[model samples]
Target: MFRDWFKKDEKNNSRDIPDGLWIKCPQCSQIIYSKDWNENYKVCIKCGYHDQLTAWERIDLLIDYGTFKEIYKNVAPVDILGFTDTKPYTQRLKEAQEATGLKDSILAGQGEVNGIPIYIMVMDFRFIGGSMGSVVGEKVVRVVERAIVDKFPVVSVIASGGARMQEGLFSLYQMAKTSAAIGRLSKAKIPYINILTHPSTAGVLASFGSLGDVIIAEPGALIGFTGPRVIEQTIKQKLPEGFQKSEFLLEHGMIDMVVERKKLKSVLYSILNHLWRKVW
Candidate 1:
């Protein structure tokens, strides 16, 4: 009877636990309940690490309900180079699309922030590291152009690893294209606010991402033109502690402020309220 009891106890103890119920914070290594983490905008309660959000999640967090009308929805990437590494570029694109439900890395649209109309573009890091490719560039240019025509402010949330390597020169060309479009927006005197997230680096940072009228980054985000390891190797010196983080950038005047995720919407609304007169 004791053997049977032990067997029953073991069976009860071995009952299945659902996956993804808890998440370990990358910054603090604290295991957090998934529900609580999500409720707090995926920010770690202990360490305050701002976790990456999906493009749709960002839209829901920032935009008023039912106010986002996505433009350039049909603009998808094409494998013009037939590039192949471990896998074909087309296959990689297909997988990314399937996995993220995004046609490309970016989602460009018109949205309302506290009833204030604006044009917004949000990049999803899940799609090939949010790499800027031909489609991404085209969509950016088109969105800015639309904002110019509509006489509205433009807000860009940048989260990219860099230019997409698969597109080769085509990807690099987008830096110029996006930067030139932003120049036109500036010429029109429209307010262009850039929100840089973690891993905003390389070509994207060198171009339009850096050309914002007001640049804001989240706390602890990595924002720089090059990775610290490569830079240290090239310079033959150790880099500063917290180098390339948003707070570091702010101290050096590279960014305007480091805002928390929960307060971003109100902050953006305040910016729009202050800048709305320029649009009129």
Candidate 2:
């Protein structure tokens, strides 16, 4: 019966299996149908593990259909330091751009979430581990500034390793820059909802990522200023089990909630509706 259904469905009629027809969950190694995976918002139905989302995918998942208007599209990165390890930084940037179809690791824009207007920023981990460079910082700052001006509630979805190393001090400086931006929004009494996805860490976590008025993290997401391995080495002691994971963070009072991907949109809407109305 399943074979018959696959044959009759026009979308799967081709002799060659469609791209992304099956995805294996990294956590549980369950073979999942692509449609089912998307229907569940890229979460594993078997192990309940949430997969990472690209910047565009995150936007689509959260934003109301046909409502997103992107900001700062022209703000591309510049190679200021002429840095090179094995290859030049510019070459790396080109390759990342081609692969992700984005000028940078982060995307910022305005969109509606369940009829509530919002300004949103999302990071693509595929792009240099979603590094915060000069462009990324500037874009985030601009997005927050726009939110303050328009009085739109803000949402920043973070999935990053840290600040870009190629840009050197330029990247590190973004921490202060973005932090200042978020601070301004705080002064304006704007609600900033931060959703930390898998592996939000390093300078990104130390800065604006942790400054959200309401911080929500996905289940099992790694949230910390440093990697567990580094911490273990530095402290010369074995770390606690599940250290830096979202649930652990919540237990330690580091974050407000550990929301599942399926419930994230509704949870965000509920928070916005409840808090925003009180402020407005």
Candidate 3:
């Protein structure tokens, strides 16, 4: 009986040690309590570095509790090109789907932000680097169309390495398709806000990503067509400091505002409320 009691005490003592109690911040390399990091919106308290959020996490952050209703959840990507490199495209798609619990990189839904009804589409970088393929393009166009029909405002959060190269020309075609959809939104005079996150680039940046009525970017986000390394290699010249970053883009008139992660919701709420008097 004493032996059994000692074993039970040992088990209880072992359980007392917390699992994943501390996390290392990628930016500052600061050891922070996991709970504290999460409570601060995943920003490093020491260096103020904002970590990327997954599509669902971002949706929860911006959308009111129990208000987000996802639209076009059934839309899945197609293997039109049957392309393969080191691995089969089908295998890649399946793996990404299972890992992210997402059918594609982009998620479109309607939600209330601070009690204001709005339509939002958010792209996640974890899925194939958040590349926009035919399905992503189609979903974005649909979001704009729904906004037009409902006369509601639209917001698109872009975080992509650009068009999905696996789809070849089919992926390139999405640039034009989404651009045309945004054109319609413009004609309708519906407010379309684009929120550019880390590394918005390539065909996505050239298309609907930049066609926003107001373009806003997160602090330290990279926004440009071609990457700085590629540009430097092609030009055989060194690039300026902080090139294509959100602050640099703001100075160059490429984007409207650069907002910190914590203030994003309030800024968005203010903008949406300003656009629609009934949003309050």
Write model 2 residue lDDT over 1-280, tens digit each, in one string: 7687556666656587678899999999999999999999999999999999889889888999999999898899999999999999999999999999999999999999999999999999999999999998999889988889899999999999999999999999999999999999999989999999999999999999999989999999999999999999999999999999999999999999999998889999999998799779
Local distance difference test scores for all models: 0.94, 0.93, 0.91
For candidate 3, the per-residue lDDT at 268 reads 95
lDDT of 1 by residue, 94-206 (tens): 99999999999999899999999999999999999999999989998999899989999999999999999999999999999999999999999999999999989999999
Misplaced by over 4 Å in model 2 are 1-19
TM-score of each: 0.97, 0.93, 0.92
RMSD of each: 1.4, 5.4, 4.3
Best-first order by TM-score? 1, 2, 3
Number of the top lDDT candidate: 1
Quality of model 2 by C-alpha lDDT: 0.93
lDDT of 3 by residue, 31-50 (tens): 99999999888888999777
User: Which of the two, 1 or 3, has more TM-score?
Assistant: 1
**Model 3, 92: alpha-carbon shift in Å?**
0.5
| CA error at residue 156 for candidate 2, angstroms | 0.1
